[model samples]
Each structure stands twice: as C-alpha cells, then as structure tokens.
Target: MKKSLPKYFRRFLLACAILLALFGLSRLYFRLTDDFRLSNITYKMPYRQAWEVPEMSEAQRENFNEILNQKFYYVGKGAQSYAFKSEDDKYILKFFKFKHLKPSFFVDLLPSVGAFKIYKEKQVERKNRLLNSVFDGYRLAYAIHGDETGLIYIHLNKSHELNKVVTVHDKIGLVRHIDLDEVPFILQEKAKTTRTVMTELMNNQDISMVQKRIKQIFDLYLLEYSKGIYDRDHGVMHNTGFVGDKPIHLDVGKLTEDDRIKSKEFYKPDLLRIVSKFNIWFKANYPQDYPTLKAFMDEQMQLIFEDERV
Candidate 1:
C-alpha cells in the first residue's frame, strides 16, 4: 500500500508539471499570433529647418557655432524658425534655452528632472508590456529622447525638406509644420465646430442626435484617459480641436513618480479644468448646446469615476 501511494504522488506531480508547461506554451502562442505590432510603431520625429539669426552678430554666430560644434549636431534656420539635427545621424536633438540659471533653480529642478526621466522610461516599458498583455485597443506614445540645452542652431538654407530633417521645434509646441497647423484647429476650431453643429442640431429639437454625438465625444475622452495615454488637458484640447488626434502626453519630462499610481487629487483638477473649458466654450458660442454638453459631462464623470473605477 505504501509503494502504491508513492506511485500515485509521482503521477500527480507529473500531471501538474505538464499542465504548467501547456499553459506557458498557450500564452506564448497567443503572443506570437497577436496582430498588434507594438514594437514597430514609429513616432514622429521633429524635422530640421534653418533659421536666420539676424539678432546675433557675426562674432556671436561664430562663438555659437564653435560651442555647437563640440556637439555632433548642427542648428539650422528655416522660413520662420530654428532646429537642431544630429551631425552623425545618430539621434534627433531639441534645444531648450534658458536666460539664466541660478544654483537654487538647478537644485530644485535636477531631482524632478531625474524623476521625470525615470518615470518616462518606466511608462515606455509599461506601454510595450501592456501591448502584449491585453487587447485594450489603445496605443500609448513613446518618447525616444528629450533633454535641456541652452543653445540650438538652425541652417541658413532649406536644403532638406521638413520630413527628412532630424530635428525641429516650434513655439506653439509642435514637432512639425503639419502638427502646428493641425494643433490650432484641434485646440480652437474643432470644439467650437462640435458645439456649434450640436447646438444647431439641438435647437432644431434633435435631442436624440445631440445625445448620441455628446456620448461619442465623452466615450473617446474616457477611453483616452483610461489608457493613461493622454492627460485631461490634451483630451480637452483634442476634443475641442486644440491639438491633433495624436496623443501628447510624451512630455514625461514633467511627470512625477506619484503620477504612475492612481491619484484622484492629481487627476481631478485637470479633469475639472477640461470640463470648465468645455462649459465656457459651449456657453459662449452655443448656449443651446448646454443640455447636450451637460449630459456628456455626466456621462464622462460616470465613465471616468464609476464604470472604469479608476
């Protein structure tokens, strides 16, 4: 009887091992067969352009060039602005200019900057991991590189077109000219258009259509927020037509370690801010759209706070 007991125990252990192996193999098969290619998505790189530095004297330009030459990239100027591109085609660079930096400022900002970089790296890893974990139907933006530097150069001529250049920057916070054009319309025009179109529809007593449209917008915002792919501000910007459809949370340069966790205090103010903007826009341009807007807000609140339980 004791010998038979040993035999049974060994069989049970063997069965458990087989089951575990099969489960792992199934997981691997699913991952391999998944249609989404998270690894292959290409982020938009800033294009390089030449900027005329009429403001700087020739001596200053020579000095600036000497300083910039130490780095591998060259600064170029274009029709309206300047940009930095790598000389060796290794990386795209953007320059952040500061007038004067005090010791206190550096002391305060350095830690935050380091934390932001770490958080950004973690977020990028999380994005890649989540792409394989579930079919959430959302893609998170990845930041390839970012840094702070005092001076940036722009070329004197438009030898390379916008798309081929390695680095580009705009005062409006766009990486490209196309994004610049789309951003203003997204931030200012789309929201107004949506409100106007909905209001006109509502005024004609098309309550059903108004509800449907509002719900659609609210759902999009909720989905964007849930994925952690966008902030509430950009969500509003995107919803209202302030920015392009592309997610804009890549400035993880400002992200804190606490931001990774679910914090109501952190997210609530931004959410309310967006709602306020929507309210102001609707009230000013289309008072008749208020009812639908309110319904949409309520739906967003429920979706954000209740349904997702975020």
Candidate 2:
C-alpha cells in the first residue's frame, strides 16, 4: 500500500522537478547556439573557458583552421605581426600569436571554486562587453577580430579600382562592407609599441610613383589632420601601394599618442626630400608618367596650402 504524500510536500517535489527540467533545456539551448569552431579551437589550443570564438557559419571556422595549417607565402611583417599571403592571394591572413591564457583571477583569489563561479559570471561580460568595443572600431580597420587568439583575415585586392568591397562581420553576426583604403590595423596588441619606421627603399622599381603618391598622401594627411585624426602610420609607408590610382595605407595601428590623439607635426622638408628623390626616378624610369605626376603633386599642394590659409 502506497502512503499519500502531504499537499505541501508534493508541491515542493514538483517544483524541484520543474526547475531541473528547465535547467536541462537551457543547457541544451546553449549547446545548440554555440559556435562549433570553438570546439576545434579547444582541441588545437588550450581552451579558456572564459573566452570564446564567435560562430560565423558551421564550416567557416573549420575551414579557417584548416587554412592556418596549410602552407602560405610570407608577404611582409609590420611591427607586432606577420602577414601571410594565401596561395591564391584571395585573402591575406595576418596572424598575431598570443601567449596561452593565464590562470583566471578567480583562481588567484579563491584557489578553489572561484574560477568556476567567475567563469560563469564573466561569460556574459566577455560576450557582450569585449565584443561591443571591438565592433565599434570595425571601421578603423576593416578586418574581423577573432578571439584573443590573434588571427585577422583581410580581403585581397582584385582590381586596380576604387569602391572595391570587402566583407567583415560585426559583433551581432551581420556582414559589414568596407572599402580598401588598403584598410589597415590588422592585429592590435594590448601593449604599447615603438613607432619605428623603415627607410626609403631605393631599389624599389616604382620608387618615383611611390614618391608622388607619398607627397599627395602627405597632403591628404594634413587635410585629415585638420579634422582631428592622424592621417597614416609612418611605419608602413613602403608597404603602401596603389589600386586604380588610389594609395592604400596598410599599417594603420601607429598613432600620434592615445587613440583619442590631438596632434602631430607635419613637416615639409622631409616630404620634399621624398618627392625630389622620386622626381629623379620618374624622369629616368617613368618619363611619360612624370609630367602628369608632378602636375598632380602641384595641384594637391595648391589645395593643401589653400586650406591651410583659411
């Protein structure tokens, strides 16, 4: 014979069952929504239960991991990172490898279950706060910021043309299109770096063209400077190249001071030296383009001087 449970006792048992069922469903939902590539990341590298790789599509992350394994030609290196041009040159993968995640702050504090609790509490913060800040600066550099692991994918230049489009994903998993001002700032490190720049490469075949563009870009910088922004990094000047007559600034990370920087001096003698060297090269190598190039330089200088006077 079964003993009948009291009414209050039955209610308590039923409530426990309902809560357990809801918890189970919530776990399942998390599993379903989670980006699967994160599992691959865990397998290849040490997993930080705190940080996660946002899921794009099912196979996108998997294919990206595979690309990392494949052989790629070395393109060049900026200050803090290396650039690898993919086999077909369809995309250039800029990778900044980071040290493995440290022991969580919770572990330092509690030495026991604190990491577990902190991980749960910070999961939302990691997903929301960290991602929000990165997405806001997507325009500063039109490259996708993967997790702290340090891999950035940039679209390759196809034609010498303006209005060329590139694809980058925002924090909310939507596609954002941007132009290739040779959009710079690929993999940004948290630490500060020396703002060292390379000297002029005399042996470069198109040195004359580069000089003209440099002078023009320098003028453009003055124009952009008036609006309260650093025009371009002095470091990657050599790497800057053209797509349909437009100069693409590659390294965008170098700053005058802080991210909200105020001013930097734009000197003329330094710029003139560059243009003069190029003038010699253009007359010797690219004579036909030299006349128009100087004309263009003169015109840009006119605009810059005019704006300065106003």
In lDDT terms, which candidate is top? Answer: 2
The TM-score of predicted model 2 comes to 0.34
Write candidate 1's Cα lDDT for 217-246 as tens digits. 445444444444334224343233111222
Off by over 4 Å in 2: 1-71, 76-81, 95-227, 231-237, 243-246, 257-284, 287-291, 307-310
The residue-level lDDT of candidate 1 at 93 comes to 38
- Residue-wise C-alpha lDDT for candidate 2, range 1-89, written one tens digit per residue: 99999999999999999999999998886455332122211212222322222333647545554544443444444443345454444
Model 2: per-residue Cα lDDT at residue 185: 22
Candidate 2, after superposition: displacement of residue 253 in Å? Answer: 4.7
lDDT of 2 at 209: 49
